[model samples]
Target: MSTLTKQDPFSRLLESAPTNFTAARILAKECYLAQGIPLAKAEEYKFTNVGKKLEQNITNFFNADSFEVSEELIKSSIFEGFKGDVLVFSNGKFLPAHSAKIKGIEVSVLSEKSDLALGSIAKPEKDPFAALNQASFENGIFISIPKKAQILKPILLLFFNQANEGQVIQPRVWIEAGDFAEVTFIEQSVSLGETAYFVNKVVELKGGINTQLHYYRLQNEGKPVLEVSNIESDIQKDARFTSVTISLSGDLVRNNLSFNLLGSNSEGNMYGIYLLNGKSHVDNHTNVDHTIPHAESHELYKGILADQSRGVFNGKIFVRQDAQKTNAFQQNNNILLSDDAIINTKPQLEIWADDVKCSHGCTVGQLDEEALFYLQARGIDKMQAKGLLLYAFAGEVLEKIQEESFRTYCDTLIQERLGSKF
Candidate 1:
C-alpha cells in the first residue's frame, strides 16, 4: 500500500481541536479521514502526486515560528509602486499597524465572534479549503463596501510568509461588496528566507445588484512550499464579478474557484494563468453554478509547463432546470515545453435546462511548429523563436488585463520564463 493511504495530518489536526460545532468543520474532518492523502487511486487526483509529497513531509506541516514584517519588506513586495489601501499580514496574523484604511472603506480583523456570519457569507459547506481555513485560521482581514460606494483606488491584501523556522501557516481572508459597490482587490502571497511553509487561504466575496468586482491573485512563494487556496463568490441580480489568478511560484499549488449566479442577469468571469518549470505542479479547478435564469459565465485558463513540470485544469459549469436562459462557456489551453511535461485538461458542462446555451472544451499540445519555423526562417535563433511564440500564446489572456502597469509587469514575467526580454 502507498504511504498516502495512511492517516492524514489534516484529519488528526481537526480531530484534536477542542470543539467542532459547524457542519463544514465536520465535513472537512470526514473528507480528510476518508481520503487521507489524495493519490493515484483517487481518480480526481490521479494525474498529480500532491498526496505523496504531503505524506512524506507531513511531520513538519504545521510548525509555527516567530518572524517579523518590516515596513521596508512590505514596500518591496508591492507591485511597481502603485499602492492604495494595503493590509499586511505575517505568519497568519493581521498587522493593523501596517494596514492602511481609506475613506468610505470598511476593514476589520476577523475573529471567532464573526465565524457564524462569515460562514454564512462564505458558504464554507461547499469548499474543503474554506472549511479548513475557518477551523484553523484565527485572525484575518474583513473588507466591506457600502451600497453605491466606489473604491477609486485598488486595495492590496499582502500576505507575507515569514516562518523562518519552517512551519505551516494558514491565512484566511474575507471580502464583501455591497449593493452597487465597485472595487478592485488584489491578493498577493510572498515568502522570504527560504522557509518551508504551507499557506491555506480562503476568500469569500459577494456582489449585490448592479455591483462589480475585480479580484486578482498572485502566488509567489519560496521553493519547497505547498499552497492551497479556495475562492467562492455569490452574485446577486445584474451583478458582475471577474477573478484572475496568476501562479508564478510555489513547488506545489492548487486553486479551487467557484461562483454561484443566484439572481437573473448576473455574470461571472474566471481567468487563470499557471507557469511551471522543473518539477513544480499547479492545478486549477473551477465551478460555475447557474441557479437562475438569464445568468452567464465565461472561463478561460491557460498553462505553460516546461521541463518536467505538470499542470491540471478542471472546469465544470452547471445550469439548473430553472436557469432557462443561462449562457456558460469554458475553455482550457496548455503548451508543453518538453516532451516529458504533462498536462491534464478537462472541461465539462452539466445542464438541466433545455433552453440554456453552454459549451466547454480543452486542448493540450506543444507550441505550433509552423509559427516557430516562420520565426526561425526570419533569421531569429531557435530559442528566440520559441520564446516569441510563447509570448503570443499567452498574449491572448494578457490583453484582458485592465491595468497597464500590471499587464506589462505580467508580460515581463512571462518573457523571463520564455527566455526573452519584454
Candidate 2:
C-alpha cells in the first residue's frame, strides 16, 4: 500500500467537503494531515486495510445530495411487529415527513449552535475515520432523554441509501441519557440499489448516574457496500450500558466500539455476532476502560465464516491504577465452515491495579464432527444437523438480546444465512 498524500483522492475529497463544528473540524483536519489514513502496516489495522478499501470503492466522498424515499419502500423496510418511534434518514439526510412523533424524548438535527458533547468521549485526534466524520459530516441527529424518563418503546433509526454512482455517506449520532433514565435504540441500514457505496458513521453516547441504555446495530447492506463505524460511550455511577452488533452481509466492514467506565459501581456489556459468506470481510475492534474502582465489564463475540470470507476480532480491557476491585472478562470464538475461510482473533487485557481480576482468551476451530455424527445417528438429516449445531453455537450470544421482537428478527436472519430453515 502506498502512503496517503495531499494529492490522493481522499485528501481532495476532504478538502472539498464542508466542515461542521468548526473548532473540532479544524482539530480533526490537523490530525488527518498529521497521521493520514491507517495503512496495512499500522499495528492497530494490521488485519484490515480500511483506507485502501475506502480509496478503491468510493468515487465521490461528499455526494449525498439526492434524498428520495418512496412510501412503499418505507413501509416495507420497517421491522414487522415493531411498536416504536422511528426516525428516517435517506442518503444521510433526516426526513421529518416520514418520521414519527417521538414522545418523552427530544430529537433534533445537529447544527452550529447545538450544544454538543461530541469530542468529549470519542476524541477526533485518536481516530482518523472519526476525524473525517467530524470534518465533513453535513447533517446528523441528537437525542436527549430527560431525568427519570423511562421510554417503553425502542427508538428505531432507519438509514436508507441509494445512488446512481459510488458515493460516501457520513451519518453522525449523539445520545445523552439523564440520571435514572432508561431507553433502547436500534439502528439498521438498508441499501436501495446495487451501486457501490461507502458509509462512515460515528456515534457518541453518554449515560448519567443510575441510567440504563441499550444500543443495537444491524448491518445487512449486501456485497456492494463498504462501512466503517465508530461508537464511543461513557458510563457514570451505578449506570448500566449494553451494546449488541449483528453483521450479516457486506463487502468490507469495520466496527470500532469503546466504553469508558468513569464512575464506581458501573457495568458495561458488549455482545456481537457476524455471519459472513462469499468474499465478504468484517472486522470488529473493541475497548473497555475501567477508570474507577468497583466497576465490571463483559464481552463475548462469535463469528461463522464460509466460502472465501474473512473475519477479524480484537478486544482489549484496561484497568487503571486507581481501579481497584475491577472485574473484566473478554472472549472471542469462531467456527469456519469451509477450508478456504479464515479468521484472526486476539483478546487482550492490560492491568495496572494489583487487586483487579481480568481474563482474556480466544478460540478458532471447525465444527465438531462427533457432534454432527451423533445428531445424524438420531435420525436428523445432515444439513439439519449442521444447522442445529451452528444455531446452538450462535444462540449463546443471541440469547443476550433483551427484546423479544428484535431477537426473533435476528434469529430469522441467522437461519437464512446458515442455508437451513431449522
Candidate 3:
C-alpha cells in the first residue's frame, strides 16, 4: 500500500465510494494507487505541498448524516442579482430541490446510461487529484448543450461544504458543447462552518466545432477549508473557450487549469486573479497546448498577497511542430504587500514550430514607491493610496471578464478583499 492509502481520510474515502461508473472508477483507482500523492520534491508540486496540507488538515470522509441543507441556507448562498439556472450541491451531493431547469440544455447526474465523454480530455492517470476525484466522486453533474443551440443565460453551479468534523468532499463536473453551441458557466464554492475540510474538484469540458464556451470559477470558502481543483478543456475547429478564476480566501488552495487547442482556428483565453491575506495560500498553474495550425491562446494571471500569505503561478505554452502559424502569449505578475509575504512565478514557452509567435514573462515586486508617493502627495491617505494602486494593478485581468454583472460582482469581492473603501 502507498503512503497516501495509509492515511485515514484517503482510506475511508476509497472504502466509502460507490461502485458506480465501474470502468472509469477502476481505471482511476489503479492509476491513483500507482502514482499515490505527489510530494514536495516532485517537479509539479515543488512550491505547493498539497499532500502535506491535506494530511495535516483533513481527518476523514464527510458524514452525510451530520449536516443537511436548509432552504434558508440555500437562499443565502445564491449569487445576488443573478437570475439564471442554478445547480446546488451540498457536501458533494446534488440537490435537485434547489436547482433550476433550463430549456435547450440537458443536465443530469452521471450514470451508466449517460452518454459521457468522461476520459476524452482529462487524464486521471497523470493527475493524482483528478484520479482521486474520479475514483471517489459519489454522483457528479453532466451537462450537454445540443448542436447550434445558443443559451443566453449563464449556468451557475453552487457547491457548499458543511461538516461537524474535519472531512473531505469530492465534486466532479463534466460539460459537453456540441458544434456551434454557445453557453456560459459560473462555479462558486462556499463553506458553511468553522471545521476544517478538504475539497477536491475536477471539471472536464469538451467543445465542438464553432462552439463558444465560457467558464468562471469563484473560490471564497472559509479559512479552515483546503481546496484543490482541476479544469481541463479541449476546443475544436473555429471554437473559442474562455476561463476566468478568481480566488479570494482559503487556508490552502490550488487550481490546475489546462486548455488544448485541437483544431485549426480555435482560440483559448485564460485569466485569473487571487487576493490573499492572513496565513492563506493560493497557487494557480495553467497549461496551453496548440496541436494544430492557426490556433491562438492567451494567458494572464495576477495576484495581491498581504500579511503572511503566499502565492504561486506557473504557466506554460506549448506549440507543437504541426502547430504552424500559432500565436501564444502568457504573463504572470504579483505584488507582495508585506515582508513576510512571498510569491513564486514562472512563465514558460516551448515551441517547436518555426512559423509561430510565442512570448512568456513574469514579474514579482512590491508596490511602486514612486506611484505611492505621488498618491500620498495628492492628499490621499496611505491605506487608500495603496488600495488604489493595487486595484489598478489587478484591474487588468478583471477587465478581461466580458459578462457585465459578473464583472461587477467580482470587482466588489476584490475591493472587499483588498479592504479598499474607494
Q: Estimated TM-score per prediction?
A: 0.91, 0.97, 0.96
Against the true structure, whose lDDT is highest? 2
Residue pairs with colliding backbones in model 3 are none
Model 1 weakest 10-residue run by lDDT: 1-10
CA RMSD of each candidate after superposition: 2.7, 1.5, 1.8
Cα lDDT computed for each candidate against the true fold: 0.77, 0.87, 0.85
lDDT of 1 by residue, 314-382 (tens): 888989999998889899999898898999888988889999888889888898889889988989999
Ranking by lDDT: 2, 3, 1
Writing each residue's lDDT as its tens digit, candidate 3 over 1-422 gives 13544653565666677877778777887877777787687788788888787677666655333246777887887767786788888877777667778898888777643446566577888788888888888877888899999998888898878865667777888899999999989988878778888888889999999999999988899888888888999999999999999998889998999999999999999999999999999999898999999999999999998999999998989999999999999998889898999999888898889998888898889999999999999999998888889999999988987777788889988877675666
Q: After superposing candidate 2, which stretches have Cα over 4 Å from the reference? A: 1-6
lDDT of 1 at 2: 32
lDDT of 2 by residue, 1-422 (tens): 33454465666556776655767777777766666778888888889988777667777756576477878888899888788888999877677778887878888877643457567787787778888787777788888899999998998899998855668888888899999999999999888879888888899999899999999989999588888888999999999999999999989999999999999999999999999999999999999999999999999999999999999999989999999999999999999999999999989898999998889999999999999999999998999889888998899999988877888899899987775574
Give the clashing pairs for model 1: 63-167
Q: At residue 113, give the lDDT of candidate 2.
A: 38
